[model samples]
Target: MAKDNTTAGIIVRTYMVGALFLLVFYGVIFYNLTLYTEDRNSEKRLQLLSEYYSEKYDLADFDTIQIDPLLTIYGDYSNLPDTLSAQFSESWVGATTFHIDNDEEYSVLAQRIASASGNQTIYFVEAIGSVELDQVDIILFQSMLTGAGIFLFLIAAAYITRSARKIGGPISSLSNQLEASESDFSPINLSGHLPDETKQMLSSVNAYRARIKRALHREQLFTRYISHELRTPLTVIKGSLSVLRKSGNDKTLKHVGLMSTSVAEMEELTQTFLLLAREKLDRDVVAVDEQLVDRLLENFSGLIQRNEVHVTRVLSAPFSLDAHPQLFSAVINNLLKNAINCSLGGKVSIFLSPERIDVIDNGVGLGEKPRGYEGFGIGLKIVNDICDKYGWMFKLEPNPSRGCTATVLLK
Candidate 1:
């Protein structure tokens, strides 16, 4: 369900429960009050009827009102009190006989009063003349009311149960969907429109998916640069060697030299691709020897010489700490290569210290860092990653000269 609807449902159920409780209390109170008020009025009527009968019959001579006379004088006492009493009036008016009802209370009381007919009068009063039916009716009505209250209670319980299920089922479904979605995975299926929190979560999940997609896209482009563009030169190099066999002339040696150069270019491109491809390498932290960095840099000394870049070193004592060696090399090599490229054949300076290796190149200082474009051409990114993973620091800034200095601090 939608957030608004769920909230509304909860609010509605709360109000319903509140109203139901209030109504039940009111009903019970009113029913009891009706019984009490009716009883009180019945008592008053009994007294009044007794007096009326006394005046007519003048029964100081009678102790109880006869059933026939009571019914004739007061038509109904169904809503009256349970018992009645009065004093016998000796100076009462004449009545040769008294009327009576056939009901059990009236019959029993009538017999008692009649048998005691002397100078004494007997007064008898009762609610509904019939003891059994009045009690039975009250019991039955009360039972009906109890049943009604129980039914209403059950109805409220059912509504609450259903509402809880509605909310829980959707929330549980959303939790499962969230668990299934990963950083790279796309398009999580939330079966229906959910509440606000879930919708917000889905939006965030989608955003995360987009970031991964972009990373994957970048990786694809990186792969393409190696496989296709660089592969062409390697293919040309292979063709040149084969052509040398067929030509057997001065052209052969020239083609052989060209082939050698193409082979070198292919090797460099392969290294670059390999470096970029090491995304998940060194997932576990392991010690990396600092000497390894220096050694790796020495491998590129020949390139450094060819480019006329002065490589300076402050020989650092090698210390082993957590790192990914192959991935780390990508960072170093890229930075070194970029520095060399940007040097414009001016002295690309490289400095190695105890804590870090600095690659300084006299060039256009990263040209405003090339917005919306990021890679390891300058090699610092992979270096930065090494620092990030190892909890170290990597810095890149403009050199005092017209160049840029890239620093990678080892942990």
Candidate 2:
């Protein structure tokens, strides 16, 4: 899933987002931990004072006020003022807070140290301002720690960002180089300054490129070999037919001309197949010199008659196209052949417009394209490739009338 998104985006978002969460989590945890430590220390101080004073000042000697270096002991509940009494009543063991002076408060512990004298409430007051000062130091430490963590994180992020770009830069460069090379069908080259990993990747790409070039070389050789081999026989046959046309009777001359035409078309098809393989045509553009609909229908007349299919040609105007006749005819022939093959003695309509040509057939309507039709399928695939090379729009869709429509738009 991460592969679908950009690499840099994922890296930045994941790292930055995770860092923020960690900072927040740690800040809360550290602050609470400091507060907990302060509370525990205060409790310990109160407990020690209570133990020491309990040993020295017995319950029988319950004095109202007993001063010490660390603590000011208050004896008996009734001795405390009304307001102080109310405040002390609310104090807990370790978290006790009460006023020591008008402006200052002390954190202390309340306890009942009893003996045979009677129950007496005593306040073990801690020395003033210690707990408040600790709290101030904790706040300052928390701020400094948070600032330091942020500074460290920023430095780490900068380092990581630089490192990512360094590592990812060459990879991105290699990828772009591969794309450009593939698009132009050229060799890929990487700079010698690249890192070892990048060098390895470039080596792999170059090896793959070599393999493709070799395969293409073989294909071109085979095409040339087959075309030369076939042309020799075709040339001889055409010569023989030309001679026969001159010497034979009128009916024989007609048959010879048809044979000659078929031979020529076959020769053109051989050249077309070669051009398709090379993905380059001799002519970039050609003007329409013949009625395309009439030519195609006449060429496939025999097939139409055999299949008992009705053909209709509807033209808005004399159709104009910017394509070589041979290539255009090949495309039309493949589409027409497929339509005829799929239809069961049904109608095949050829609609010609200023911008497009549509061959629609009331047939099987493209239901599960039948396989094992390689000879015909390859021809159609070549047609599609030609259309793509020429930047023409080709679409095949099922028609509402239980048929399929193949549209070729010249743009």
Candidate 3:
């Protein structure tokens, strides 16, 4: 079983421990008070009997006298019980108690009386079996005290629980609201009387929300401006490349083709960046068809030829994913580019299925970058972000033999 670590649980446990300590404290005080009162009354009774006996009879005439069945008087310490005799000296003058048997208890008092001859000491032993509280009475009193303590504890526990709920409910609701919020940056709404601490927390959360909303708005504006600024140069370059291609010079045609490919790649990246910058995507689904893959492959065909890397594809079936075309293209393009770069002069394979897309390479594997090859940079980061936004699983693991396999689970 899991231990309760919630605020309410902690408060309730602390209160119970404190309550138990108080109960024990008061119980000890009550027991001591009862014993104190009994001892005082016994001493008074013994004093009164000594005064009456001294007025009625001679103090030094007898060594012992049985005044009552429960009371005895001794003129000196020599005639007292062994337990009583052990406690008194010539100057001792106070009350004490001793037990003769398991159930027999006696309260003894020593007093000095004035006689015609000299000062005399007398001992009064009183049987207090009925005066002192019995075991059953003590147990019953403790039981009642315990019962009352438990009853009060239950009531207090109920109140504490209710108070804890009152304190914890708003915080819990705030947590759930934050978790449920995806792109919504509106302030959280909580309905109830809230504590000051909770109000402070809510204020902080709303402040953070406002900051995030402002930052995202700035990001969107920045990406839009960048895309807008780059498109003009891209358009001019594209127009120049088209004019060059139309020229009847075969020597410059290859250079123009390369420039055009580079321009196209830059344009695609701009679009992908703009799309990624937005807080939300349009409800557009793109088909992951062979034609799209073929186009992307064709875009990188020059690099593949230059590197002498063999590329293979295993498109079992066509599938549609709920994502923007540019974003999905960016993911595939980055993955393919990484695989191609890593597997220079080697093999790069693409496996597409309804469940996932696997891009396998058998060249440098992981952590081994060729000359001029930058390690998986912003490309994989973008891929990972896209996968997370789409709730897709992306994994890159080293193969058993060589290289690594990048798998994007679409299902």
Q: Write the per-residue lDDT of candidate 3 for residues 70-163, one digit (tens) a residue.
A: 8898888788777656655767887877655567678888878777668877888898877689768987888898889889988998998888
Query: In model 2, which regions exceed 4 Å deviation?
Result: 1-21, 56-143, 183-189, 192-197, 242-261, 279-298, 312-328, 350-359, 364-376, 387-411
Output the lDDT of residue 105, model 1. 38
> RMSD to the native, candidate 2?
6.5
**How far out, in Å, is residue 335 in model 3?**
0.7
Per-candidate TM-scores read: 0.40, 0.66, 0.62
| Best-fitting candidate, scored by lDDT | 3
- Candidate 2 residue lDDT tens string, 195-236: 787788778877888888888888889988898898999999
Candidate 1 lDDT tens digits, 191-259: 665778867876786788778878877887778765776678677767767777677687777667656
For candidate 3, the 10 contiguous residues with the lowest summed lDDT are: 81-90
> How large is the C-alpha RMSD of every model relative to the true structure?
16.8, 6.5, 7.6
TM-score of 3: 0.62
List per-prediction Cα lDDT, in the order shown.
0.58, 0.73, 0.84
